[model samples]
Target: MLEDLDALSLRVQRAVQLAQGLQAERADLMAQIQQLQQRCQALQTQQAAERDEFARMSERLARHDLELQAAQKESAQARGTLEIQLHEQRAHAQSLQHSLQASQADCDRLRTAASGAQQQIELILERLPGAEA
Candidate 1:
């Protein structure tokens, strides 16, 4: 009976040691679970920040596209205005050239008529009595 009681006490001591080991393992597993949860939270925050940055970039790109389109439209309008001014200037220059040509022709005719009149006067004067003397 003494030997049986000693054996039973030894088995109880072994069961107590096993229970303590299981508790320690459970504590370690709980600490690991907490660390994983913290890591997941940090990732979610970073993803939110990245999404905000992407939205800002997309808005900036859209504004730049609108500006580019406006610039293109203004450039086209300016080009058209310049073309119209150039055509008008060319027409005015042609009209001035025509006026100058007509004036030059009138001057030539007047010079010819004056030269013939001078010749007739000289001849009539020579035919007058003692005009040569």
Candidate 2:
């Protein structure tokens, strides 16, 4: 009976050691689960922020597209107006050139007639002076 008691005491000691080891393992597993939970929460927060930023950028892009379309329309209108004004200015310049040519021709004819009249008056003046004899 004394030998049986000694063997039972050894078995009890081994069981106590095994229970301590299992407690240590359980604490380590609990710490790991806590760390994993924190990492998952951080990832979720990051994803939410990224989603909000994407929405804002999408709205801004839509606004820019609208502005671009408006600018294009304005540019097209301005280009058409400029073309029309340029055509009118060209026509006006052509008409002015035609008028200038007509006026220059009339001036040339008048100058030729005035030179002939001056020569005839000089000849008459010379004859009158000789008749003074």
Candidate 3:
């Protein structure tokens, strides 16, 4: 009977030690769960902020694209106007060149006629007796 009592006491002691160890382990698990929950909340907040920033950037890109399109259209119109003006200027320059050529031809003919008149005047003077005297 004494031996039986001793063994039962030993079993009780071991059970109490095991219960304490399990309680310590549960406390550690609870602390780890709290830390994980906090980390998850922080990550969620960061994700939301990143999403908002991405949306803003997307809108800005769209606006920039629209502005670029408008600028390109204006540039194209300016280019067209410049091309038309250049064509007109080239045509005017061509007309002036033709007019200059015709004037040059008229000048050459007038010079030839003047030279012939001068030759005739010299012949008349040479034929006149005592003209130099």
Candidate that would win on lDDT: 3
Q: lDDT tens digits, residues 40-65, model 3?
A: 99999999999999999999999999
- 120 in model 1: Cα distance from truth in Å? 5.1
TM-score of each: 0.66, 0.75, 0.79
After best superposition, candidate 3 residue 96: deviation in angstroms?
1.3
| Cα error of candidate 3 at position 115, Å | 2.2
Q: Which 10-residue window in model 2 sums to the lowest lDDT?
A: 124-133
Clashing pairs in 1: none
Write down the lDDT that model 3 would get.
0.96
**28-131: candidate 1 lDDT, tens digit per residue:** 99999999999999999999999999999999999999999999999999999999999999999999999989999988998898999999999999999988
- Which lDDT values do the candidates have, in the order given? 0.94, 0.93, 0.96
Cα TM-score of candidate 3: 0.79
Model 3 misplacement above 4 A:
1-9, 125-130
> What overall lDDT, based on C-alpha atoms, would model 1 receive against the true structure?
0.94
lDDT value, residue 108 of candidate 2:
93
TM for candidate 1 is 0.66
- Full ranking by lDDT: 3, 1, 2
Q: Candidate 2, TM-score vs. the true structure?
A: 0.75
